[model samples]
Target: MADETESGERGNVKTGGCLCGSVRYEVRGELRPVVNCHCSQCRKTHGHFIGYTSADRNDLVLAEESGLRWYQSSEKARRGFCHQCGASLFWEPTEGSSVAISAGTLDAPTGLKTVRHIFVAEKGDYYEIDDGLPQFPGTMRGHPLPEA
Candidate 1:
């Protein structure tokens, strides 16, 4: 179990919350680069593409959770949101300690960058992904999720 600070990163602590401010949280580890997910579930749940950055579960601390709710989206995954404001929040693998934090929920100065666009085949018909980053037609099973 290596401490997050051992990565030569700063405190590696970032605070974020839902739109209504009722579901604040703190992430205290290294965050993977932001990935724009265009899977149908994500598009529908967020009413558009969803951006996320992941961190180990052990490093996350919930400071306030009064409005948080978790929806088991699939056998292997769950989605989290704010009940008070309907703000999409988290995505976590059911069997792992890692969780994906909604990139939009983090306060500015995130010090993060978009690493890639995933599930592009299921993207909405209304828009195009022309941001110049690598676009994968599906998940990162064959392809790898890039590190920041």
Candidate 2:
């Protein structure tokens, strides 16, 4: 990866934990720009549209996981959260080596920006996505990444 240096350490590193510190993690890799998912499952799980930033699974190290639990949210993916604090933390695709980390769970000054909105077709009717960022009617699977 271009972000890696001679020692194989990524140029960027970040740390975060759950509300109760039951699930702490160190991400020794580049974090993707944040993407907001408006899918119903995300809304239900997070009580609102959820923002996520991704990192390679290999680059993620769980510093503490005593209270971590995984929920198979769908046949394609699973969600991870802190059992003690009920803090949603991760979204991992069943077939991928990259995992999405809940942006809100990361420590402040993440140097990340919300780049796009996904699953807009299923977004709740009560609110409008007025930020004027790129909005996709569904997932970003086949779509181009928004210009940062």
Candidate 3:
């Protein structure tokens, strides 16, 4: 099985839009392994856990200029969405290595695999994560786990 730490260069891929098909995006690099975030914020935003993958900011290209709004979710992070239809599209760092895109937005099928589950402790009470993937109790930077 593929793991989260796996790294490689991404090539151009077609990706886009919300439920209403009002937004579109294109990425030109390898899609980072998927990350399953069980954090409250993620669950609340996505109506469940959020499955996402990161890509270099340089590789992210938005094809359309309409229906996008950026919300500053934290001091260093912001969430992008469709202003008209309210679709969560991207998660970007004010300053970081890459921007995370909703994996569901990709237009073509990808080989990306999910490696870890974040905020396991704070996951919703109604659901149980039985995937046996690595689970962290908090944010990625809050604690360190032994190297795999």
Question: CA lDDT, every prediction?
Answer: 0.87, 0.90, 0.78
Local accuracy of candidate 3 as per-residue lDDT tens digits, 43-121: 8888998988888999888878488888898898899999888889899989977999988877655667778888899
Model 2, 18-129: lDDT tens digits are 9999998879878889999999999999999999999999999998999999999999999999999999999999997999999988876677899999999999999999
RMSD of each: 4.5, 4.7, 6.5
lDDT of 1 by residue, 102-123 (tens): 9888766688999899899999
- Which residue pairs in candidate 3 collide? 10-29, 10-30
CA deviation > 4 Å runs, candidate 1: 1-10
The full ranking of all candidates by TM-score, starting with the best, is: 2, 1, 3
Q: How close is candidate 3 to the true structure, as a TM-score?
A: 0.83
* Candidate that would win on lDDT: 2
Top-TM-score structure, candidate number: 2
Clashes of each: 0, 0, 2
Error of 3 at 120 (Å): 0.9
